[model samples]
Target: MEGNNDTVVTEFILLGLSHHPRAQAMLFGVFLVVYLVTLLGNGLMVVLIFVSPLLHNPMYFFLSNLSFLDIFYTTSSVPQMLVNCFSHQPTISFEGCIAQMYVGLFLGIAECFLLAVMAYDRLAAVCSPLHYTLIMSKRLCIQLATISWAAALLLTLIAVVLQPTRFCGHNVINHFSCELQAFLKIACSDTSLNDLLIMTNSIFVLIIPFCFILVTYGRISLAVMRIQSAKGRSKAFSTCGSHIVVVTVFYGSAMSMYLHPQGKISSDRGKMISLFYGAVTPMLNPLIYSLRNKDVKGAFWRLLGKKVSE
Candidate 1:
């Protein structure tokens, strides 16, 4: 009994979004299209940001990185999920599951902090126009982006290391991807400690940054109000609106999924919410920014026109 085989589960079976045979067949096509769109949308956004000199600014710098994060964040699970759609028993290796969970969680947390950074960038641009350049230097922007990514890794790594040690029985994950909550449901040990660690860290990655963003926007609102020109006020809101829309979509579904009050958001609920937050939002981000932000639209047309000439 030195190493009991029963004490360890090598893999987990994920029950994807639907259980119906007919639905499963249909869902494969649906998710395939979604996955492709997520790639194309986020991918093109990243490429456009890099190539367009007009877009080479601190704000677009963060947006480009955000698009990159959305690309990888969606990629971390969607491909495997698409494959699972056709499988009889959608299974993932223990290590594969751990890696997937960490990647998704890391990108998600990074986005939270990055969005907050962008919020501050907007605040300085609107509230402190004279010092905007000094406040958001290239070096400072790079450092902020670097810190967001590094902090996410550090925070998610804590859960990644702690969660796997708790896995003992019931390896059936009730979701398409190897999500932390899905793992928690099947973990044989008492998951109160793991959940506590998760909630505690969620404060950093989810709640605190969101609060900071709200506060920044409050000051931004006041600053915009004091501007004499209607056009100037309109322009300020137009610029910040895109970010606000994206933040709403991303955090709305994420908070619904993770920060529920009942403490028992069913796995059935989990699958639907994950499909939205994980797959749908990434596809929407580029469209939101491109359609609303005048600069991105201008850059996109310039880039497209250049490409056509070639």
Candidate 2:
């Protein structure tokens, strides 16, 4: 309970993205736009998929889940970061920080697994078109979705339960939000067990799922190459184009952040890396999926026409 000088640390001060008044103002505007776009974009995707029967299949089913995750992921942390941007002395109660850390970790891990499940769906659609529906039945889809969420919950609980309990040092977290790694730096208790747990969970939640995605995409590529008609090949590639982009952008920054050796990267650079996935990636998901796909556009037009006719 006692921190430095035998003081109890009850709150953590967040050194937000910037300290300069002008810079903080600019960051506030930028992140505010990003937060709003992330909400509207991901929110629209969920609603669009829900109403469009054309998007009722496994691909969009998974996409709708992804959209929901993106919404939750950004909402969990971005609002707090935005508030910290304007506060003269941005601080969060120790309990608030713990809650933020766990929620953010769970959503992030869930996305990692959900993306891998999506890759498998793509594999089925491309590699076995005739049996794609049979392979990705509603039951299997629900099971995969449930497992992704349940696994993330289990892993996050383990990390939190085994985390270093005592905080006997300074309570300044260098990052904007209560990031797990940033919070861990402020812990006064021994963190070897926590470190091991993070690494183990990262392997399951990041490295393994990412590798699975890569291999699944490789098989899809091979299957596409064997398609006899040019139109067929193009269509197959188009079906997966958005997912591939999302996976690359999400996993690239995430793996770089988690898998790389800790303490080797600078604090500011680490914040930038986190910002990409935490803010930028969620904003890009709906854009990437909608802009590149003909199905979503067609569904939008159809819905628009139905509304006008009514």
Candidate 3:
């Protein structure tokens, strides 16, 4: 089904999670529950940050943005996955695919940058506590969040717009969602530039922020060690524990997904990893933050009390 240079692909089929009814049915239920919880968890984070004055600082500001991005990141894929599970034909139009790719890429990259910003915030809080307020000012936090969203969107937009996706003979995408790599696999045309761009962007997202996080955390760790009081050192480390846990979960999957050489990882592994970051991790983020950080727990209780009183 290879088309000539003049070939135009109007639609593409997605060979979703499984073909077996029982598998699909079971997956459908699981995905639906995860998607709902993702929305609820992230949505609640966003709302609580906005309404709770106690949580309106830079750390929570970046966190709310993360929650916001996670909401859309999961939304960009999981709904389609859920639909495809029940659908006789998991088909997406060319336009729909492009939209999905752009949204997913934007959010994915933004989250990377946002996490780096969070790392810097932690460094400031731990390594330079006296000036933490000035370092992660509300103004700076907003600027970082804005840059994360805008930079990711604009850069990805340039790539998607510059490279015209031409599907010659191949139109079957063997994934639940219109992932950029999966879409590229199905494009039956010259994709050298697109592949190069994906590689470059992926590398940038994977390397720069990750290096920064590691370095900042290293510095923070050193600073914590310098604290003479056991209680002081323990508190400082506690502040970072939740974020470190999150960073580990996120970067582990992201690195495996993006940094590996092309075609080395199986598509099945890719899908599972994608599900890990896209769906599962968002649900885990709030729980990690809440369970580990007493500030979050106290804030949650306070918010709940107000609601109960009302």
Candidate 4:
């Protein structure tokens, strides 16, 4: 049965953060600096993790992969957005839009799961120190990372494949990039199934991981409290603090953008929030994790010393 179709959208115009001429230069400079920092920060982490034998543990191994994902995750959308900040017409082809959406969703979801897995790794290391190595072995770390990537890819594939069936009402996308929610709003087809699928996916990919992180942190807190020495408790809390902060920002902003009702909020306002999670969060993660970490700082100094000696 063929449904009534009025029009087909071949491309989408991305109404990025602002259209002001003066704001363009400022936004470009800001994002350019951010992009450079994001690249350098994440790239350095990956290199350090690979080169430094001290960082060969499962935690750093996962962190290396997380850094790599963050790099690509930001690259997938931010560059284009930056380009659009200067371009007269910021349009993405229909196919390009779909691709961007796919990559963004895949990496975003993967990061969520990866963070939870990292939390679990930390929990095992802190709460069960004796069995830490046994539980988070290299093989198990590889398996967990593989599962995170595979699950994200599978979900993204499903969402993209289902998208073609939906009718495109308009070619304009209000956000800076092609997002699932923004695209769904313009879909003329009955989107009940799509909405249901998105909700289910959110529960699995977002909510489940959030629950795991929360539970793990709860256990970690209990374990920290049990420590007799103040120094031990403080050390434990400090080690987990960075991860907790990263998780909070990433998940908090994402949930606010996706799960919250868009009722009275303007589309432009929503776009700014989306930009924070989708672009800004990825850029900030590596900096937050590495800059605040003693291990990472020590690794950086050693790497720099080696460079200086050469």
Candidate 5:
């Protein structure tokens, strides 16, 4: 059997969500529907924001970018998972696994920073209405978005490059896709450095932004309280309510999964919580924003009208 020195791992078996055939089929159906909704919802948001002239403000601009990132973030893992559900031999090459991990990490981190930037945009608009234009100019928005993407890419690159610890044990990943924690856990060599790096990155990427959002909202709340009319306060809170809900769900799930001691929680529970932030949250974002915001709804109608006219 040892012809030369070619010990190639052709593929890796993905120990997907379930082993039972019926369970796999059921799970596949559910994820297929979820994936479709995620695609359509995020896709529509991007298109509407892009084409609508009235939506050409800093807020909607950030929203469009968020939608785009959500699409990729969900797609990076969910489709692979859906495929694995039905595949008799659910496998991904080593290179493919690495690529998936990189994309997922990059987009997930980018979304965190982008959401924080969006909070700052809202704060400037609400707290300093008079100088909103001067403060959040198109150029400045572009700069902030650029920084978000650059930071995310840098973090992902470092993580991927440092993950050279050989996989000497079972090649089968327990989860559907190549998750960072799962991959690190299975490494044959010491992963203390990798763990430290991941923790450091998580602090800056997730914890810092979460704190920034909290402070920004606190200022916004004070500003809202100062408004003379109850209607004014209601309107201001309504404008922020959707973003607040999203921020809470995303950061709450993420922090619980990463910030705490993983040894305390069962592995299955951890995977389930990870699915909420990684898979479900992206699918829910556009629905929450569009359903709740009159501006976005109006833009949707306008876009629809233009399509009909065309």
Candidate 6:
């Protein structure tokens, strides 16, 4: 990265969420807890789904994929965020910043697609109960998960390859991490192309998948209403309620941050939004599913009982 006035830009100073030492200490404790919970919660979900025969269906298959994604997704930035909270002047190497930016992008986009896939899985279970097993077979589940991950990889690669090589101005990033929008704000060179790429990527990774989820739930609602049994309708809604909450938090924050027109971004607002989606949402995902989902609770106790007996 070229620096202004012949100074080579080697790293960036992160102006983290708070400048006050007291506030930083408080935030450190808060985020440390959040990070640990994200890891343990999502990690347990993955292990439980893998080990429990009761969770071997397509729904839990997609869920396990989501669990893995949340684990990595939060890990990409939260560790650095925790470190920055204690540092008087937080800095990230140029290479490290770039790595954080793209890694988060990849995992975040994967979740967007994965959530859509989960919505489709719910539609099958509720709308086509008789054929749900046939429609969401093992092969189809693997293929869908593979495509979600592969597509995110390809999109992230394109964004990286097309990024402007010159970053000739300031090296101070005004956020906790090297967030995409915050990173873009620091580029001294013309970033019209980069801005365009972000918009296009947002459409594919955020907009389209969100729309798909909405339509899928629309179909799901109609199917549930058609069921004559109140018990059946209640069951159908229970199956989708957790997913609906997760999608709203994740996609709503992401779209607000990424889809806004250039120059409309507020520094403070962006940081808060990033914190919610990046840290808060990942931690909430496993909790939401486990609390709302009876099968997950059942499998957990069953595993606990087996270990206790052993």
The candidate that wins on lDDT is 6
lDDT of 1 by residue, 1-310 (tens): 0135446678888888446768888888888888788788888888888998888888889988888999898889988987887788889998898889888988888888999999999998999999988999999999999999999889888876676454555778888898877777776566777788877877777788888988999899999999999999999998988888888887788877778632479878878888877888888888887887778778778988998999
lDDT of 6 at 172: 88
TM-scores of the candidates are: 0.93, 0.96, 0.94, 0.94, 0.94, 0.97
Candidate 3 lDDT over residue span 121-217, tens digit each: 9888887888989888878888888888888888888786755445665778878888777777766567777767777887778788888999999
**For model 4, how does the per-residue alpha-carbon lDDT over 1-310 read when each residue is reduced to its tens digit?**
1246556667888877557768777888878887888899889999999988888999898899899998998898888889899876799988899889989999999998899999999999889999999999889999999999998899988887677455545777788789878877777677777777777887898788999999999999999999999988887887899899889888887877667533335677777787777778777878877776778889889999999999
Top candidate, metric TM-score? 6
Global Cα RMSD, each model: 2.0, 1.6, 2.0, 2.1, 2.6, 1.3
Which residue pairs of candidate 1 clash? Answer: none
lDDT of the structure predicted as candidate 4: 0.84
Worst 10 residues of 5 by lDDT: 1-10
Q: What lDDT score belongs to each candidate, Candidate 1 first?
A: 0.83, 0.87, 0.82, 0.84, 0.85, 0.91
17-77 in candidate 6: lDDT tens per residue? 6477898898899899999999999999999999999999999999999999999999999
Residue 15 Cα positional deviation in candidate 2, in Å, after optimal superposition: 0.2
Please write out the lDDT profile of model 2 over residues 198-255, one tens digit for every residue: 7787898889999999899999999999999999999988778888888888888887
Q: For residues 64-174, write the lDDT of model 5, one tens digit per residue.
A: 999999999988999899988888778998889888988998998998999999999989988998999999999999999999999999998999778844656447777
Q: Report how far residue 304 has shifted in candidate 1, in Å.
A: 2.3
CA-RMSD of model 2: 1.6
Q: For model 2, what is the alpha-carbon lDDT of residue 279?
A: 81
Rank order (by lDDT, best first): 6, 2, 5, 4, 1, 3
TM-score between model 3 and native: 0.94
Work out how many backbone clashes candidate 4 has: 0
